[model samples]
Target chain A: MIKLLPRYILSFILLVFLQVFILNNIQFSGYINPYIYVLFILVLPFETPKWFLLFIAFVLGLTVDLFSNTPGMHSSATVFMAFLRPYVLKVISPRDGYESETLPQLKHYGSAWFIRYSAILIFAHHLFLFYIEVFRLSEFFATLARVILSSLFTIILVLISQYFYRRDIKR
Target chain B: MRSLLNFLVRIHFLLLFILIEVFSISLLVNRNSFHKARFVNFTRQVAGNVFVKSNNLKQYLSLTEENQRLAEENNRLLNIIESTYKSDEIFFRSVNDTIFNQRYQYTSAKIINNSINKKHNFITLNKGSEQGLRPEMAVVSEGSIVGVIKGVSNNYSTVISLLNLDLKISSKIKKNGYFGPLMWEGQGYQSAILNEIPLNADIQVGDTIITSGFSSIYPEGILIGFISDFTEKGGSFYEIKVNLSTDFKSLDNVNVIGNLLQTEKLNIEKQAEQND
Candidate 1:
């Protein structure tokens, strides 16, 4: 646990930096803005306490909100994602269930399970995020398109990142 | 009491989730209201500092474009001065310092951050109360109106941009004086919708739209846009499309307009309302 603490802290800083400095600047057309910051919560250890997970998620979302100037949009969406994380894990758990010390990574879960897990949470996060952002139902279909496109973009980026990290962990 | 404590322990995580969500929703809803003034002001200041630092690094890349714009503005000003001199001596002499009471004063500021994609777009300016800026002051770019000051802190301020759906500017045709309210339809940044112009108004595709000066925020005759197209709305009013004069994407420098008589004018209007 002590050894893992520093690694988590380092990745947290790297993820936030990448999000605010790079990803936030990339607007693929006007409708799609990929949000990869939620990956921080998605990759947490399966046995982590629920209260701790929620707290970390809130802080992460608030930090992103502060930098992006969106106030509560990111935080609200992130909390919703965190709240649904345990149930998602339960629904997709393997025959013997997840190990206590292992984090949810592509290597341990394989490609199929990992993809389904990420898709469910990412879709939920993006759906909540884009709706809260527009704050109106008048442009429902337009906002829905944004949510779908942005979720796909973010999932692709997350999967590619997982591949690289998986190799590093193997080495 | 023991059972209550046990139940509380059982639902602790759910309770925590609800509490955090409630806090976030409150923050989101109170963003545009007076209740969160202090919170928004603090966030703006912190975010403003970071953007100013980043803008300093990035602004160097756009130096050439900025210089070209400044040069063009200078030429336009010189042409206006020379035309005034040739047209009327009385009007030219009225430009003298003692003759003019200077109802509007301008403070120059640079835009550190701006957004065009959102429905309610806002621009962040570098100047704030330290530079005598306040809420409701008019902000203009080189030759066109940009927005009005919506909030101000000590070192930075936020302008509700002209592209915002919430902003409606009173505008009129410069040729025939048929006035209407101009608003953004939350589509592209280049065009906006002008409504309430009667069908009989002789408006053309290329007629200029200038400020009506009905509101105390902006002065009369500031250029807004030009008529691009018009169609009758329900056979009574004209639903005209306007091509905005100010290009918001490349905008940088702006001048905040401070009206000296705003307080007095608002006071008199309030008194008249009481009598009515």
Candidate 2:
């Protein structure tokens, strides 16, 4: 756990920088804003304490919000994602269950489980984020399109990054 | 007591989650209040710096188009100046020059960041309180009305763009003087809806719309849009669609308008209401 602390801190800074500087600027047809910062929470070890997970998620989201100038939208969405992460893990747990010290990485869990896990959480995050940002039910379908397109883009980016850049998770 | 303590410990994670979520939502709801001003300003400064830096790198690619727009504006200004001088000379011979007062002043600013896709879109300007900008000033581009100032920090201000669903402008037909309230429908960037124009008013597909100046935010006769189509909603009013004159997607330079007589007008109206 002590050894992983520095790694998590480093990735948090790197992801926030990439998101604020690069991804926020990439408006592909004004619908897709790939939020790769959620990858920080997605890849945490399965046994990470729930309280710690929520705290980290809040900080990560608040940092992004400070950069994007949307006060609470990102933080609300990310906290909700963190709250749902454990239930999602429970639902998708294998017959043997997850290894205690293993991180939920694409390399560790294989493609299928990782895809399912990331897709569900990313969809939830995007839906919440878009709704909170818009804050209206009148444009429901338009906001939904934004959610789906952004979620798809974010998931693909997360997958591509995981596959190409292999990082060792100490067990 | 022991059993209650154990239960609380067991559900501590859930309690913490709820606490954090509630805090975030409260922050969202309190966004426009004065207490959130410091946080909003801090974020604005950070985002403003980043956008200004990135826009510097990207601005060169659109330099030619921007120059063309500026040159056209210069020509228009020259024409207005010459016409004004000619009229002034004619009026001076006929009557005294006491009828005109400078009611509005303009400050130019660059749009560092803008969005047209969201339901409540906002544009960030490089000007702020230091430039004498207030919360309700009108923002306009060379061609048409842009938006109204929503908030201001020290070095930057955010404008609620005309594309937002929350903003509605009083507009009128240019030819026949029939007027209505114009609002965005949140679908396309180019078109907006003008509501409550009477069905019997002389209107057409190609008629022009301009600011009515009924609201003090915008001055009179600024070009807003041209009527594209219309339909009768029930029996009395026409739902008119207008293609906006300013292309919000390519907005760069804008002017924030300061109405010199707004406070005086508002004060008089308030006094009248008090008497009534």
Candidate 3:
């Protein structure tokens, strides 16, 4: 079942629904809006083409935007992060890039490396999303505060999801 | 044709990024109109429903403290009323009835969604159109004025929390009635600034800031904040910082002040504005 495309598609739909309906509604603090939908962009196969990955990120973000009604905020931010993902991966590249069929996960890359990689991507996405939401250098300090707080919340949610749903990919 | 196809495939990600950026830029530029505010209000309604349930859960835990606070506040209000009026007059007007034409009405509703950390902060309330809430009604929490209602649905309304950079209210010093423009400095939730007060005016720290009754939204004499610090800016005006009384971050309930004569006052003002 895990070998099939339908399995991943099913999981993706479920995650997106849960995100828009449940997680988006969960406001732990005013600052913490956990965006767990980014997991769709994160767990794509290692061999997925760069162009395909970027396109997936665009769709993933646009879907969230459609539900949240924030217009292009998530899409712009996600695409920018997707554009930088290659460089981020290169910087944190494992011994053999990644196994051909393995997806990015702690089970595949270990906790430390996965955490570092996810943190960079999540921060990059959040920084772009928040700054664009309120586009002004005059609001720099406020934007920075949002970046740190939202990133922390996003990271914690992502880590918890990763811990519970360990992927079947081998290192 | 094959070579062209390969070239297109090579730069697909860059094309996608450009497309999304263009979309975002357009949204930002077009955000000022009423259409956009209405759209944002719809999003607030969805947020409000979720908040209502969560706040309901917390209400159980915080009931004892909230009840005690409400009772003590009611007692203080009753004592003030008793001291000001004859026993018969006091008895004639019920506690909930509006006695004086200037008296402000208070409606307690939970804040479903509040964002103080953003440059443009908005708050979603659990009460709305059915509860006599309409656009432009003033909101206050714990005696200090928050902001006016910007949008309303049947069961919810979005408030422009005082922390927003876009909101400016007319406020006066409690002691002297010297007026200034009150706005959030886009910094902390607890602080705001009063701008355009003349430099020569007698100003001091800890002076109370209250609504000036100049606007139809908020009635006069409602507390805004306290003057914490001031400095001469640009040699003509004193820029004063205020410590906001309402803790927006921990805001649970608010009173949406329904002004009786707002529509009539606004029509007159519109006519005046047009003539000017």
- DockQ score, prediction 3: 0.36
lDDT of 1: 0.87
Residue B32, candidate 2: Cα error in Å is 2.0
lDDT of 1 by residue, B1-276 (tens): 999999999999999999999999887777667323687688789889988987887799888987988899899989988887787776756677435677888889999988776666778899998889999999998759999998888999988899877789998889988888999887788989999999988988988999998789899899999999999998899999999999988888888899888998999999999999
How high is each candidate's TM-score? 0.89, 0.89, 0.78
Docking class of 1: medium
Q: What residue pairs are clashing in model 1?
A: none
lDDT of 3 by residue, B1-276 (tens): 999999988887678668766765566456445323665567556666766776677677888988988899899999887775757666565643744554456678777666654566777788878888887789988778888887777788777889776788999889988897898876667899998888778988999899998887788888988889999999899999999887776677788888887778889999999999
Taken over the whole model, the C-alpha lDDT of each candidate is: 0.87, 0.87, 0.76
Q: Can you write out model 1's per-residue Cα lDDT over A1-171, one digit (the tens) per residue? A: 667788789888889878876687667887488899999999988878999998999999988876665667789999999999999999999999997767898888788999999999999999999898878899999989989999999999999989878766543
| Candidate 3 local lDDT, A76-145, one digit each (tens) | 7887888788778888898766766566877778899889988998998888888887777876886788
Q: Where does model 3 sit among the CAPRI classes?
A: acceptable
Better of 1 and 3 by lDDT: 1
True contacts kept of each: 0.55, 0.55, 0.38
Per-residue lDDT over B140-254 for candidate 2, one digit per residue giving the tens place of the 0 to 100 score: 9984999999888889888889988778999999998998899998767899999999989989998999999988889999999999999999899999999999999889999
Candidate 1, DockQ score (0 to 1): 0.56
